[model samples]
Target: MASPGKLDTRGSDFARLARQITDAGLLDRRPFYYAIRMTIMAAVYLGGWALFIWLGDSWLQLLVAVALAVVFAQLGFLAHDLGHRQVFRTRRPSDIAGLIIGNLGIGLGWGWWTTKHNRHHANPNHEDHDPDVSPAVIVWSEDQVARSNGLPRFVAKYQAYWFFPLLTLEAWHLHIASVKALFKPEAKRRGPELTMLVTHFVLYFGLVFTILPVGKALLFLIVHQGLFGIYLGSTFAPNHKGMPILTAEDKLDFLRKQVLTSRNVRGGLFTDVALGQLNYQIEHHLFPNMPAPNLRRAQPIVERYCAEIGVDYLQTGLVESYGQALRHLHEVGAALRRPLPIQGA
Candidate 1:
C-alpha cells in the first residue's frame, strides 16, 4: 500500500500530464478530419452495397461480402470515435452521430455499446470492474477459471487456441448483446435504438435475400458477419488483453491505473488507419477524448512523461502484441490443464 503522501503525489501525476497534453492541443476536436473521414466512409459504404447489387447472383458476390465486412468494421471504428466524443465537443452531437453510424450504419446499439465501452475505459484491465476482462465465453484469470463451469470451464483449458476462431462469432455476440441491452429497465433511448436496429436488419437482410438466391444470401451473411467479427476483435485484442489484471485491492491513481495496464503497438500511418488509431493504447487510455488523428502526435509526449515518472512504458510490434495477448490467455488456462492429483498413491 502506498503512503498517504505518495498517494497524493500519484493523484496529481495525471493532472500534470493532462496539462501538457492540453497545451499541445492534442485534446482539441478535429472537425475537418472527421468530416473528410465520414464522407469517405459513407461513399465506400454505399459503393459496397451498389457493387453487391450489380454483381447479383454471382458467387463473386462473396468477394463483395468480404469488402463490406471491412466497411462494417470501419464503421464500427467511427462509432467508437463518436462514443469517445473525439469528433464532437458535446454529448448530443456525439450521441446522434453514434446512433446513426453505430445503429443505422452497422446494426450496433449506440447507447448500449457506449455504456459498456465507457466502463472499459474507466477501468481497463480491472478484473472486477472492466467488462472487457470479465468472464464470459473466455476467462481472463485463474480465479475466473476456478469459478467457471459448463461451457466456459469446458473451453478454459484451450481458450488460447480457441480465441481467434471464437472471434468469428463476436459480431453475432455483439448484435445479440445490443438487443438484449435495450430490454434492460434502465436503458436510455430504447425505442429509437430498437427501431434503428430493426430497420438496419430489415434493410440489410431484405437486400441480400431479394438480390441473391437464398443459398447465396445465407453464405454471404456468414462470410460478412464472420469477417467483421474477426477484424473488430483483432483490432481490440491487442490493446489490453495480456496487460496486468488488477483486483479491487490494487489501489492506484488514474495515471498509473490506465498507463501500467495498457500496451501500445508500434506502427506507421497504415497501421494507424487500420487499427482506428487505437495502436496508441496507452495514450488512448490516458486521454480517452483525444481525437484519433492527434494520438500519433501525443505519443512521444506521453512516452517521455512516463519515463520521467519512472513508469515502465510498453510498446511492441503489431505481431508481437497479439502474441503477448495469446500467450497470456494460454498461461491463464494452465491450471486447468494440469493433471488431477492421484489419491492414495
Candidate 2:
C-alpha cells in the first residue's frame, strides 16, 4: 500500500507484480493473430488501390484513396507492435516485419521510428531527453514556451486550438522525417530500409499518377496524407500528452515513471483495433513486448497494482483525453503571456 513514488520498480514489489503477470500468461505472443491481421490489411490496401485504379479521374476515387490511407495507418499500428516484438519472439524477425510494414507499406523508416520510440519508452515526457516532448511547432512545457521565439512562439499561443488541424500534416511530416533519417549516417544499416521506403514512394506515386491526371493525383495525395495523419496522430497523441511530464534531472523508478506519465483511453474492441491497444498506454509502457490483445487483460492487473501502491492511474474517454492534452498545451502556453516580475519585488 505504499505510494509508487516511494517504491522502487527494481524492488520485490514490482518484481512480484511482473512475475504474477507473466505467470498469468498474459504476456504470450500472438504471432498467428498478427499474421492474419496483417494479411487482411494488406489485402484491403491492395483492394483500395485497385478501386482507385478502376475509378480513374472520378471524384469517387477519393473515397478509395482515403480507404487506402486508413489501411496504411492500420499497417502502421501493426508495424509498431512488431517493433515492440509483441507479435514475434525473435528481434530480427520482428525488425524485418516492421521494416516491411513501415517502410514498404506506409513509407516510414522502421529503424528511425524504433530509435525514436525506444527513447520515448525509456524516458517518457522528459523535457530535454524525450524526443516526443521536444518542440516541433508547439512547445510542450512552460519553460519551452517561454524560450520560444518568432513563428514557434506565435504557434504556441494558439497550439491548443491548432493542434488537431496541425496534425493533418503529421503524415507528411512523418514521411519527410523518415526520408531524412534514411540519409543520416548514424541511423545504422539503413540500406534495406532506404530501399523499401523509396519503393513505397515510387509505387505510391506511380499508381496514383498512372490512374489519375496530375490535378486529381495531387488532390488524392492531399486527402490521403491528411486523413492518414489524423488517424495516426489521434491514436498516439492521447497516450502521454496530458500526463505529468518529467525533467532530465528528476529520476523515478520505471513503474512510477511509466504510470504517472501515461494516460489510458477507455474503450472496447473497436478502440483496441484502431489504437492497436495503445489506449492501454500505461500497461503498454510497462510491458512493451506484450501482445496488443493481451494489453486489455494486463490492464486490470496493472490498475489494481497501481491503486494498491497509490499511483495516479489515469483513464478517460477519447474526447476527454484530447481535451486533457489541449488543456495542458494551453496552460503551458499561458506562461508566455505572463509578464515578468520586477527584480526589486
Candidate 3:
C-alpha cells in the first residue's frame, strides 16, 4: 500500500465520521474517571516509595523499585492522556498534570513529549517525519537500514531478535534524551519543566544512594530502569510497529492513513488499564482528543464503520502483535545484507 501522508481528507467518510464522533460528545472529558484513576495510581506510586524507603538495603527493595518504575510509567501515560486534553476540559489544568507526572514523576519533559507525540499523531509511522520511527539503534525500514553504518548497521542486521533485550536500555535513553532536550540553550524558556526533571533525578538518586550501598544501588537502578523501559515500549510498540511505514511523499486520507497504520490489541479490562486504554490504538488515533475510557465505547462504532467501507482494521493478541512487529524488523533488516551501491560510479 502507498503512504497516506498527503491524501485528500475533505471528501473522505472519515471526515464525516469524525464529525459524528465529535457531535456525539465522545471528545468530551471524563473528569471523574481520570480523577479516580489518577488518585489510585498516585497512591500506588507513593506506597511503593514508602516501602522502598522503609525497607532500606534488602532484596525486597529491588521489588519496590521495580514496582515504582511501573507506576511511574503509568503516571507518564496519564500525563500523555492529559496532554491530549482527554481528562481536562481546558489546557491549563492539563498542562499542570502533565508537568507533575511527566517532568517530576518520569523525568521526561512535558513539552518535549507533547511536541514529539503531536508530530507522531499527525503522521504516525512516517519514516521521515515520525520521531518514534526515526532510526536509532533499530532500523524499522529497508531505506533506513541501507544508510546505517558501524554499530547501528551491525545491530540493524539482527534488530528483530534484539528488539526486546535492547529496550532494557530505553529507560536510560529517555532520561538522557530528556535532559539533553531540556538543557539545550534553545530550551531555556522551559526552565520550570527542566527544573522538575532535575529535581526528580536529584531526589531519586539521593534516596537510592542514602538507603543502599553502591553495588546494590547500581543494581536497583538497573532493574528499575530496565523494567520501566520494557513496560513503556510494550505499550507503544504494538500500536504501530508492525504496520505500514509512511513516507513524506505518500498521499493518504486521514481516516485511511490512521486505520491502516494503527493496530488494536485484543484483550479484556485488565489489558485496557495496563495499556492505558491504548490497546484501542485505532480509536485513539482517530480521535486524539477523546478520553481514554471512551475509546472502548467508541470501538464498536469505529469498527463497524470500517467494515461497511471495507477498510482493514487490524486487531490481534498481544503475543501475535509482538511477533508481527519483530517480523517487520527482520524484513527491514534484509537491506543491511545487500551490497551497497557504488557512489560516483
Candidate 4:
C-alpha cells in the first residue's frame, strides 16, 4: 500500500486560519506570563505538599502525594515555556523559575531546550530532522495506530510497547554529537548541563537526608517519580506518533501543520483538569503561546478550519488514545532494529 499523504491547505481558506492565529497576538511579555504561570504552579505544589504532609502514613497519603506529583508535571510544561522564554516578559526570571520548577520533574535547561525544542517546533514530523517527531522507527499512520472503538476494546487490548521507555529516555542521552544533535551543540558541554538537573536532585536527597527520614524520602522519590512519570508520559505520545510522518516532499507552513501534525486527545472533564488540558493537543500546538486555559475557546474555531481545508484532524477519547499510544510503543519495539528516518538530513 502507498503511504498516506498530506492535505492541501495553501489556497485562500488557510489564509483565514493564519489570520485568526495572528489576531490572537503574542503576549505582550512572555516573562509576565511565566511569572503568573509559576505562581500558580507554586501554589499547586505547595498546597499538595501540605496535604501530603498532613496525610502521613495512611494510604491516603499516597493519593495526596500522587496528586502533587501530577501537578509537578503540569508545572513542568509551563517551565518548558520559560525555558523557551515564551512564558515570561523577560528571560532572567523565566530561567530562574523554570530552573526551579523543572527540578521537581526533568530539569531541562533554557539554553538546551531553546536549542532543541525550537527545532522540534520548526521541523515537526520531519523524519530525520524533527527531533520532536518520530524518526519513522515505527511505521504506522494515525488511523492505523489508534484504537478503532469502545472502552473494552482498548483496556482489554494493548497496542504500543515503546512509548514509556522512549518518553523516559527522550532526554536520556541529551544531545549527542551527530547530524541531528549538532543543532543543539551546546549540549556537548557537561558542566552547565548537569547544573540544570541540580534542583530536583537536591530536593530528592535533601528531603531524604534532612527534611524527613531517609526511608520516607527515598520512598517518596520512587512513588512520586513513577506516578509523575506516568502522568506526563502518557498524555503526550498520541499527539505526534501515528500521525503521518513528514517527508521532504511535504512543504508545510506553520498554519497548515498546526492543523496537520497535532491530534486532539478525547477525554472527560477531570482528564482535562489533571492532564493540563492536553486532550486538546492540536489547538495547543497551533497556538502554543496562548495560555492553555484559552484553548477551550479556540477548539471550535480550529475544528472548523480543519473541516474547511480537508485536513484529517484526529480526536479520540484519551481513554482510548492512551491504549493507542501503548500499542504504538509496542509496534516500535517490534521494529527496534530498523533505522529511524531523520528529517532534513
Candidate 5:
C-alpha cells in the first residue's frame, strides 16, 4: 500500500504537467472557432428540416433523416463542449448555450447531462462511481454480471454482438433518462429544462406529422432517432470502453487515473470533425475546460510528458479502437457465457 506522502507526491505529477500545459497557452479559449462552427451547424440543422419539408410524402426523406441524425449528433457534441465550459468561461453562458443546443435543439436536458458527465470526468472508469460503466442493459464487469438479473443477465452473454443493435435505442434511453432526472429531488433547472424538452417534442412531432403521412412520419422518426443514437454512441464508445476499469481498491493518481482509463483514436481532419475532437480523449479528460480546437495542439505535449513519466499512453486507429472496445465487452461477459454444470455433476 502506498503511504499518504507517496500519494501526495504522485498527485503532484498532474500539477507539474498542468503547469506545462498552461504555459503553452493551450488552455486559451477559441471563441472564433466556436462561432464559425456553431454557425455551420445551425445552418445544416435548419437546412435539413427545410429539405424534409420540401420532399413531401416521399421515401427520399429517409435520406434526410440520416443526414439530420448526423447533424443532431454534432449538436450533441456542441452541447458537450458547452457543458464542460470549454466554449464559455462562466457557468451562466455555458448553461444557456448548453440548454439551447441540448434541450431545445436536440431534446436532451442540459442540466441532467452536465451533472452526469461531470461525474464521468471525475471518475472515468470507476466501477462504483462511473454511471457509464454501471450495470444496465449491459454489464461492464464481472461483479456487475453477478448482480445483474433478468434482461441484463440475458443480454450479458451476447453483449458484444448486441452492442451496436442496442445503440439504436440509445437516443430514446437518453431522452427518457433526461426526463426522469428532472423529477429527481436534486435536479436543477427542472422547470426550464422540462419546458424546453416539451417544446422540442411538440415542434419536432408536429412538423413531422404535419409534413408527411402518418406511416412516413413514423418511419422518419425511427430512422432519425435510431441513426442519431448510433452516431452518438459510436462517438463515445471508443474513449474508455476498452481501457482499464478502476475500483475502490485502485488508488491511482489523477494523471494516471485519467490517462490509463482513456484511449485516443488516431485520424486526420475528418475523424476530428466527426468525433467532435473527442478522439483526443486523454487530453480532453486532463483539460476539460480547454477549447475543442486546442485539444489537437495539446495532444503531443501531453503524450511527451506522459512518456517522460513512463505512463503508457494508448492511441489506435478508429476501427481498431471500436474492435478493442467490443473485445473488452466480450471478455467481461465471459463468465456468463460458460456452460452451466449438471445438477449432480
Candidate 6:
C-alpha cells in the first residue's frame, strides 16, 4: 500500500508481490493474437484507401478519405505494437512487417520509427529521448508542467492548438531531422531502414496521383490520415501518464520499470478492437516477445507482480484516461524549461 515515493520499503515486499503475480500465471503473450490483429489493421488500411479511391470524385470519396485518415491513425497503434516487438519473435520480422504494413498503412518511416520507439522504451520519462512526451498528448511532470523562461516553451505550450490540425503529418515532419539521422549509414544497415521509406512515398504518391482521381486522393488523405493521427496520439499518450516516473537512482531493471512506469488501461471494447493486446501493457513490457492477445491472459500474473512490488497495478477507463492525458499535457507544458534527471528504461 506504500506510495511510489516510499523509499524505505524493503525489496522483499516487491519480491513477494512479484512472485504472487507470476505464480498466478495471468500474463501470457500470444503471438497468434498479435498476428491476427496486425492482419486486421492492414486490411482496414487497404480497404479504407481502396474505398476512397473507388468512390472517385463523389462526396463519398471525401467521406472515405476522412476514414482513410482515421485508418492511418489506427495504423500508428499497430506500428506501436510492432515497435514494442510484441507482434513477433524476431526483430527483423517485426521490423520488416512494420515497414511493409506501417509504410503502406501510415506513411511512417519504419526504420526511423523502430529506432525512436526503442529509445522511448529505453528512456520512458526522459525528455531528450521521448519527444512524444508533449502537452499535445501526454501529461507532463511537475517540472515539465512549469512555465519556461522564454518563447520556445511558450510556443510549445500554445502550439498545441495546431497539434490536431497538423497531427497526422506532424509526427514525421516535425521530427524529420532527428528521424532522418536515425537512417544514416550506421543505422540504415539495419534491414536498409530508409529503403522502405522511399517505397512508401512512391507507392502512396503514385496511388494518389495516378490510380485515384485528384479529388479522391484528397478525400482519402483527409479521412484516413486524420483517423490515424487522432487514434495514434490518443492510444500512445496514456501508456506513461498517471504513473510515477523512475530516475537513475531507482536501480530497477528493464522489466521492473516497465511494470512500475508503464500501465494498462482497461480499454474494454477498444482494447481488442483498436490496440489488440496493447491493453495489457504491463505484461507486454515484461515480455516483449509475447503476442498482443496473450498479454490479456497475463493480467493475473501482472497483478501479482504489482502486489509483490507493493505498487498498485494501474488501470482506468478510456474517458478518464484521456482526461489524465490532458492533465499530463499541462504538466509537461510546465516542465519544458526544467532540468530532467536521467533514468533507465
How far off is model 4, as Cα RMSD? Answer: 9.4
- lDDT string for model 2 (231-253, tens) is 99999999989788788677888
Off by over 4 Å in 1: 1-11
Clashes of 4: 29
TM-score of each predicted structure versus truth:
0.96, 0.93, 0.92, 0.69, 0.96, 0.74
**Model 2, CA-based lDDT:** 0.87
CA shift at 133, candidate 6, in angstroms? 3.2
Local accuracy by lDDT, each model: 0.92, 0.87, 0.87, 0.59, 0.92, 0.61
**Colliding pairs, model 1:** none
* Model 1 residue 295 distance off true place after TM-score fit, in angstroms: 0.2
Root-mean-square deviation of candidate 2:
3.1
For model 2, the superposed segments whose C-alpha errors exceed 4 Å read 1-10, 338-345
Model 4 misplaced regions, further than 4 Å: 1-15, 24-37, 47-64, 83-86, 103-106, 133-159, 162-196, 211-216, 267-269, 330-345
Per-residue alpha-carbon lDDT of model 4 for 1-345, expressed as tens digits?
Answer: 112244334555456675665576532344454467667877877787677666555555556657766786787677655654555656677656655655334444545555566677776677656765532233343332243235322322233544454444333333121123324544543454455466555654564345446566566656666666666667666677656567778887776765677778766678776667767778777766665666666777778767766667788876667666566545544433347799898
Candidate 1's TM-score reads 0.96
TM-score winner between 2 and 5, please give it. Answer: 5
**What RMSD does each model have against the real structure?**
3.1, 3.1, 4.5, 9.4, 3.4, 7.3
Descending-TM-score candidate ranking: 1, 5, 2, 3, 6, 4
Q: Per-residue error at 122 for model 5, in Å?
A: 0.4
Residue 30 shift from truth in candidate 2, angstroms: 1.2
* Tens-place lDDT digits, model 3, residues 1-345: 324443334566787677767777888788788889988988898888889888988988888878887897898789889889888878888888888888898788887888789999999999988999888788888888878888778999889889999888988888888878876677743778878998999999999999999999999999998999999998999999979999878899889889999999999999998998899999999998899988998898888778766689999999999999999999888866678899998
**Candidate 1 backbone clash number:** 0
Model 1, CA-based lDDT: 0.92
> Alpha carbon lDDT of residue 332, candidate 1?
92
In TM-score terms, candidate 6 sits at 0.74
